[model samples]
Target chain A: MELLGRETRERFGLRSRSQAGILIFSLVSTMMLLSSLYAAEASVFKKAREAAIETASPILKFFAGPIGWIEDRLGAISDYFRVLEQNEALREENAALRQWEEEARSLRGVIAALEELEAYTPPPAAKPINAFVIGEANDAYVHSMIVNAGANEGVSRGFAAVDERGMVGRIVDVSPNAARILLLNDVQSRIPVFVEGSFVEGLLVGRSTSQPTIAITKLANGDKIQPGQRVITSGAGGVLPRGLTVGAVAAVDKKEATVELAADYARSRMVRIINYKFPDVEATPLGAPGAAAAAAEISAAETAPATAADAANLPAAPPAAPAPVDEGD
Target chain B: MSTRADVLMRLAGAATPALLGFLGVILLASPLRLFGGEVPTPVFPLIIVYFWSLYSPGHLPAASVFAMGLTHDLLSGGPIGLWPTVYLVTQQIAISQQAYFLGRDLGVVSIGFAVAALVVSLIVWFVMSLMTATVLPLGGIFWQMLATVACFPLFALAFGRLHRRVVIEV
Candidate 1:
């Protein structure tokens, strides 16, 4: 290797130099192309990347369908073995949860039904389409995952993505057949949350680390945000719905509190797509500014710390769009 | 013993499966759906690349590695050049170590994979840091390396044989 390096140095002829120059030029041009690819808005490039996937997806599905079939055949052999263990575990856990369910039902019976129920009504989610994963880890550093479902499956941005166990992330970019999930572990991810203990509201931030943290701004530092206390979405920014299960306050580091998601973020599979779109512009096609109004408002609520001043704010949801009805109606 | 068809056959085997495996690995590693979110890291690609680099440089061209990396970049949504760059760097290392690798046994190769996984994981983490502020625990990356390195023998042997059989024929 050293000898070749030395010999190449010695072969500094005009032709050799010309070849070197051409190589250098081509190299620079490729770098420029890649840089431009990287420089585009994450959403634009994400869409383009999704477009690429859309074109390539069919080819992949062609292979995946067969592989999935084979895997199922093999998995069936193994499935029988875990059945006994699964049954015992579920029985024991069910007994404990049923106790809580009874206690909770008694409390609910006492509360006034209508107004309280309205506050507790869970938001509707988008129609989820399921797909088996056909790729490797998407990003380890960021808490994100890419699933096989995409726009063609009615998946769109701002939809909630959760595994059978718990919340994985929200959909950020979508192609025809695949979508990228921005996990609660992503540093850029922030959703409004309320402390179940005191209803103290704050935001859940996805820090690239495995354990995501909740930043409670409205509650003064040293407010009774104790370890083992629970946290949930407060529905402040209309992005995530009210009262979604986030996680418990695992530990408090100084003024900031870190949360450990109930579901294992590191290990997840068979995620459910909760087909909910934020109350912004409609979940329209690409370039449709349908959700613009809601998007801007949600973005503002996410970025600006909620304070006493914004506490009294209740921008009524736009009158429900008239349901698409039959001509007879 | 090597023939002209060697290149054609290796490409034939790895071409579809290597990229196919890459896509498969991403979905398997996805933390979206099921229990035990064990994500397969760059190990599959790394193993395929590393094994081919040592055994038959002819079958695995640098350009193919570049394309695989770009595909990974798009799917994972990391900075575009990061994985491709890591693939190239590792490919170069594999080629350079081929002489020493010729006589090494599986244990040594596993250790070599560890070293390579460490280097690739570190470089990927660093380049990815420049993209955004997602900072996953090093433990996650390290555990990924352990799993990938542990499984090296399977892919190495499988890919190596396919290289021999297909390349020998084509």
Candidate 2:
């Protein structure tokens, strides 16, 4: 009788423990789901996440170097085996590109003539800062990368990053020595884009896959968007510059089109940060403020003849261009 | 003096999961691009979490598992709390089957890990779809699951050697 009572009590205890574990699991999962839902809107979580990324960046970069080198060596060995085929493919592509280049040159001449006729002042040149990729978000659900460039190197949030091929992403977070770029395929990424031939404006949303979701959100009624149409940034929201090549349409449905990104992010070792800022007419002068002012002063003086006193008054030719930033390669 | 040394050894042993898990996170985030295609990188930390939970559950508490997942989320640029939830659930399952796995049969453990990987991968896919408001393509997730299961045996062998050689009762 005593043994039976003891066994029954133990079984009851075990069942209760299991029940408790299940309850705790459910509670924690609920909280996590709720938090994830609000993560995009939650500033506190964003700051905390950025701080954590900053803390982990250095250690990650240190360990990634040897592994990357090994991978690169293996890739090279594999490439050697396919050299003939690859060479043939490249030759064919080069021939096609040459033909396109001639057409592009003619189009450029026409566009230039039109711009001159309209007295249009082109936007300032985009400053390029090259940075090495240090880390990547390896999960399937979120595509992003960490680069060595940061605020200290003038890489700010929303600045577009591109490789030799084309668009990579935009800087989403930056510390002093590192920044995170939200790749074009990340679920959170959204960019304004337009079809090349038709000029149909669309919203390109990342699907966390190779192809992005391109919805023709704004377009003229009855305008048909065809597959194989080129896509470029529309610069509607002012986050990215206008006319930056994004990708080409791979497929189209009634609701959305799919874009195959031009940049081969998996193979890119280095990317350039495009330091582009939309021209703020009220805030900015016609040209560089100091240089323009100095040029005007020189021209005004030259109208009569410069005296030594006038020369002293002329602002020093824009202080010798600050030595180029030392990007830790 | 002897007791102090024993405590130090235990403390070092206690830190094993955290350190190894952090290394997995680093490897997961490394920009090596080892594979040529668009397949997702193998989840290295998941292996660590599973191994430690089975062999040293008391040492690597659930809290540590949660923390590692949280760290992965912050670094991997996903929605915060997603990985933590995944890790916690996986850890719970591993812990429940801890006794069944104590025999250290590599086949059983590998099979168990494969199931865990499938469950975790499915959950991740579901949660991501919910977040993105569209049924995401499962091809990448499927490949990631396969890669993770494929890598489990190697990680288990390495970790087993470490456990027997370095972390044993000396």
Candidate 3:
């Protein structure tokens, strides 16, 4: 290796020390790039990446502190300039919302009655963990952001992240106290979604733009996707929960449909990471041991006109019961 | 001055460019939305690397550039080594063309950076597309390159001042 290096340096007439440094570093960098591509899926590489982010999280948060303060001050100044107009808009919105609230109340009652008649069981409630956006990767090719919540805060990979308006993205990497969210507009992000009120199912694929297009996976005969139709998670892959509002279809062409994301990526400061666990099939099965006992207990509790506080005090049912068959049998 | 003090000053001078490069990475990764809309992030580390390579390649060095790019990749959650390779190759190019950029006015230097930024953006777009096995959009890359080129003069001015005041002074 030393002889080859000397011969190459002599042949190229590269006598400068800096030239040697460049050559050596370029070779090293090429090797590193190739190795990284080869080991992209290796666990060690993932761990190292997580560790680097974990170490840098504190430094990033420290740098973001002043930026946050500046943003707040700027927001306040902007708000002051538009307060009157905003107040009038808010008042109009409030009046309309009151009527919608009443309608929603009646709809809730109807849904409850329908659910009782159908013996329907709702999906498990999601636990939300709040996080602050500390960093963002608005680079040429990648669109992602770092949040100040991670495994320690009940955040896990694949957990859905949402702002007030709608879905933001999902957790892709998580350290102890930090996580990276692959935003909806990143080139690598893909989510299964279906247009609301239609049988048009498709994959929401990002193209490094604000509007991600839909790649149709399933479309029933004679069903057309139109503009302004809401797009939502299909839960087909079991990674994300079903029925989360993703976005609304903004434009539809013969071969492509784009969605206008609901979450305001540019101005979103806080997000809620939803920690949801898909329920196990066996855990909710009928005819298991203790099933009749649990049903009787539930019936007894239902027979009583319990107050809300009493409902809170009720004992929770076991998730699953063991089989009662003897070993000999 | 004491020998120890002189040594510390020399070390500080040597470390200044790399430190600024790291700072560039941190600032780029930080969510400092000074603008209200989706503004493209100017490639700060690229500017830093190019400036230092043109002026004093010994101070910033190729290794430090590699580290900065790796840190950026880690923070951005992109493919590791993707940026390090880009940065190292860019640095080499900058060093090779140092003679032309040296003693040039800000406008000329910035024009040079414009060309470099265009090339780097295309390289990144091509490599990323190849890695992902799909043709990535070019709009973001174009905006980013434009922003980087537009911001180059300001960064070059700052780094030039820092170079004169501290790097050469020490």
Candidate 4:
């Protein structure tokens, strides 16, 4: 009878201990959820703050006038003593750059005019907004920052951020008046890129540390991809544009390679939004290059295709005339 | 009336954390910057945490420690929870260690402070790497901890006066 009583008591104690374990687990999860929720709530706080700032714009502007003066005075004095010579050098360098730019622009015009003359058009356009850097973080683990511009400024989530140098990162979260930029050195960041020399495609992953690591999954076991090669967005994925210079292969770390970014994250003070819309090539006539030839053949031979079908479903164009079939041949 | 001194004493107790917290952040930011080779070590926040936990737990509640950690997170640009977790854990550890450190000499106190700082820093780095799934360099973190440890004596001496004034000798 005593043994039976003691057994019941022991069982009761065991149940109580399990209950405590469950309670602790529930508490930890609740706290984690609360932390994430707090981050989401921060966006609302920023929106409210932005509204308050806007309402007091005039008063703030008055105060900013003196701050602006100090900035200008400091800039002027610094320029007078240290920057004048540098500015002169920059102007001379700028002159050369402008000449080169003009030459490149004209060459581009020649190619584009010819393509247009042949009735070439491009993918749809996207809306873009210029944004200034309010702050930058170049930490060892996470390189990111908050920009003053936000959803109120027409910035959207997942938009690719970049400067003249190259890609910056994508918009992770945004408030009405402020947005956070996840830099290329962030661990959660990744982008698809195509190797210029080999046309081999893979992903560029960030490590949060200064030297972000690149992990290419498509290459063969003994593939020989060289260093110093250029990498650009493949645009095979619908997110990023094709031919945007992402970076160059910096080093081939045994199994993978690292890319040295073109944009100096440390030096960049501003960035531009690449305005591009994913083109549904299948909807466009360019889906099959020879579609035109086959298209012309069918149109010339008959008023309509024999089968009534979607115009976009037309068969591929006939192969371009054989090399020997040229006019002189 | 039991008015003037009572209100003054209460006010001083309430404001200690905020005052100390602000000064601490300013001191801490420089040291973190120096670790990155851009600025110096910040000793104030760690010092404040130590002082409050050891002498004035009522004024520097754990919630306030967490908030201060969050603020430091914003200023230092670290992962938001990193410093707050460190602050929370350090506050707890500091409280628990007060008994061991109760009558220790200056040298022992300094060593104790250094160990506590190292533990807090390690906690920050460990949890950070776990969440981010990336390795952070520990070399700079160590140097920063050493600097904070070295400054403990000076901070304790300064805070000791205020502590004595606020809490009557028991």
Candidate 5:
């Protein structure tokens, strides 16, 4: 009877310990979840997350190697099967591009002559950093990818990424060796764009789908945006450069139109991160104006009293600058 | 063998689940781009947590589950704490139903996992939508749940073998 009593006590003790383990761990998990949910952008949690990704980047790259190899092999097989059709299409495209090339050469000469006449100073060339995609997160709520390029490789937040076809996304987070790209299809993505010919400005908003739609569209001269019209970055806010091909309008609904992106998210292994720095308007004057004159102009503009009439005469303030691009944690 | 060696071996055995769980997270996050399509990734860590919690709760503790889920969140660049909470809930459910899972055949075990996957999917979708303040698309989550359910048998087979080889002593 004494032995049976001891066994019973030990059994109860073990059960209680197990229960305590569950309770304590549950509390810890809850605390962690709450902290992560409400943490600030520069909070320790975000920093730690970036550090962890940087440490594990090499491991991810190593694992992607075999998968990329398989993808290449499959692509080669597909290419082999479609070679004849692709060859015919390329032949036609080459013939058309040859004609465009001659026209482009003539236009380049004219533009150079005009620039010389006006003493036009071109903007600095954009530097592109080539990087391989090592990881991807395409779930129901988040759409991002990790490229094997970071601050060390001249990749900074807000730098645009593009594949051979067209725009892919913009870098949002950068660690030492890896950067997170908020893909174009993420719900939080918004880019300033305009129709190719009509120049109707609008915000391209992501819907977490393959195709994003244009919102807050401003039609110029009653020009209606039609399907198949090309879309390009407007460079309104000077974040992205002008004339970067975004996509083609797939469908127009009442006020908005869906765009079929040019960059094939799938099968894009390499991307180019374009490092574009907006020219400082305050620092570089258009002509050879003295510093005092430029300063005088700035102070006059700031000190000039604005009347309701002056405000009305001013051009409508550029459509509410699109919200700063940042993905929620 | 020395006492220290014996203890070390036991600790290592105990850590098998967490180690495997982390590796599964890394593998899932890698850009496999399988079949040249935007395939939804299966929550492999959840499967690992569910399997171990059911088969040997003492070996796979809640803390390890939390660590694995946290790693997944950081690596996948998703909302923080999202997967960790989902995984902790999954572990609790699996532990609560452990008795019912014992002595069950593979088919029954898979069905239980299917149910668990559904619950996990719903929690992720619902919580993410709330966090983002938008009703996220449902099609991706549905396909992800299907993928997770379909891959359960394979993971179970692997984990079962590992359990027999390494975790049994712990």
Candidate 6:
């Protein structure tokens, strides 16, 4: 190694110098390319990238078909061995579900009477469009997928995408017949979520991993959180529907908690794109925007001793938007 | 080893490494997500690029290396030039040190490949960190490197047979 380095230095000739020059040139060119791509014009490049993908999608599908078929066949073969155990588990789950169904029916009757007295009307149920995952983002850093159903199938941007297991992601970009879903674990993803038992609100910012940590923005300093807690979408942002299963807490620390996602992204082949629209916050009763702004101001005004009191003066927990009613398949 | 079909055989021999590199990228991109997200992606191309560049630089040219990297980048959804840069640099380094590996046995080559795989992984991690402007987690990258290193022998065996049957005959 030392000998080679010394030889490279001492025996510098036209050939060696040319090779070194080529290496330097290539390195500089690559760096320049990186800088340009890093600061790429989002609008122009996004359209171009989408167009390029659209054009190439057919070829990709043609190649991917055989591989997908083989994978499914292999999965089927493996499932054959576990069929008995799965059947038993399913039977047990079915019995438990029947009991829950009976309980829900009784609760529904009581809730109906209460709603009649209060004159309450729940939001309409969201329509879900089923789509097969055709391809995933080729880049390792970008956790995303391209589903077959797109604008043609009413799969549009802001629609939350979920699989049978749980929340997968939401539609980011849609073409005529295909849509791109930015998965939950993508770095660019941030969704409002809460602990199921405690109902503690937090921002679930994706760390590009299954074990994404939740930043408890609503919590005061030194507040406690624990492992094994279930996380669910809070629907604070309105883009995502409420009560969607996110994941269970994998680890908890003094400040943040990591969640192990419920959806097995690696193995998920199909997903449902939910057609949902955020309610008009501007026209709401308490003006959610105004209250949110006030909360923000109180949060920012930390130096003042009366900060907590000032926060208290904000709207006393304005009524939450009607939760989206789940419609079972 | 020359015969009436020498030219055709040689051309096919020259193309095998790039074809294998392409297949490696395909295997990574296909539904068979190697190790199922425990590792982001195995450096399959890195193994082939290093093996061929060291053993038979003439058969695997720099142009083919760039093409393989570009193809992978297109399929990978990463920064377009990242893998190309990595592959080209790895190939150059391997070619430069080909003298050291010429008469070495499989064991020595495996050790050399392990070291090369480590270096390649570091380069990829550094470039990706710069691209994302964040210090990314190294665990996945390390796992990917180990996976790539482990799979190198299988590729070596297959490529060795192809080379012996084709190159030696041609």
Model 3 chain A poorest ten-residue lDDT run: A316-325
Better of 1 and 2 by DockQ: 2
Q: Model 6: runs farther than 4 Å from truth?
A: A1-25, A36-45, A73-96, A107-118, A137-142, A173-176, A220-223, A280-329, B1-16, B34-41, B130-134, B164-170
- Which tens-of-lDDT digit does each residue in B42-112 have in candidate 5? 76787898898888878877777778877888877776777877888788778777768988998899999
Residue pairs clashing in model 2 are none
lDDT of 5 by residue, A144-254 (tens): 889999999988889899999899988888998899888888877889999987769999988877898899558867788889999998888889888888999999998
Reference contacts preserved by each model: 0.20, 0.61, 0.70, 0.03, 0.55, 0.15
What TM-score does chain A of model 1 get?
0.62
DockQ of each: 0.26, 0.44, 0.67, 0.14, 0.50, 0.28
lDDT of candidate 1 over A79-156, digit per residue (tens): 688999989999999999999999999876755474464434333555666755444343556455667888778888
- The candidate maximizing TM-score is 3
Q: List the residue pairs that clash in candidate 6.
A: A138-B76, A138-B77, A139-B76, A139-B77
Residue A200, candidate 4: alpha-carbon lDDT: 70
Q: For candidate 2, write residues B1-170 as lDDT tens digits.
A: 99999888877766877888878888888885765644568888889888877776655666677778778888877887788778777777787787578886899999999999889889889988888888988877788879888889999999888877656653
Question: Model 1, B38-73: lDDT tens per residue?
Answer: 443435677777777667665666666667766666
Which stretches of candidate 4 lie above 4 Å from their native place? A1-106, A123-127, A135-140, A220-223, A280-329, B1-13, B19-47, B70-82, B99-113, B132-170
The deviation in Å at residue A140 for candidate 6 is: 6.2
Error of 4 at B76 (Å): 8.5
Name the 10 consecutive residues with the lowest summed lDDT in model 4 chain A.
Answer: A52-61
Estimate the lDDT of model 1. 0.64
Docking class of 1: acceptable
CA lDDT of each prediction against the hidden true structure: 0.64, 0.81, 0.84, 0.63, 0.82, 0.73
Order of quality (DockQ): 3, 5, 2, 6, 1, 4
Query: What is the per-residue lDDT of model 6 for residues B1-170, given as tens digits with 9 covering 90 to 100?
Result: 46747777777776888888877765655445533444555667888888888877667666777777766655544556677787777777776777688778877887888887778678777776776577877766677678777877887888788778876566
Q: Where does candidate 5 stray beyond 4 Å?
A: A1-42, A74-103, A284-329, B1-8
lDDT of 2 by residue, A1-329 (tens): 99999997996786456436544754775686687685665877777767877888788778768977888888899899999999999999999999999999999898899898754556689999999898898678788999888888999999999998879999998888888999999888999998888868988899877888787778787777788888999988877998888988899888889998999987988999999887664554656655765776677668635445445676542332233433432
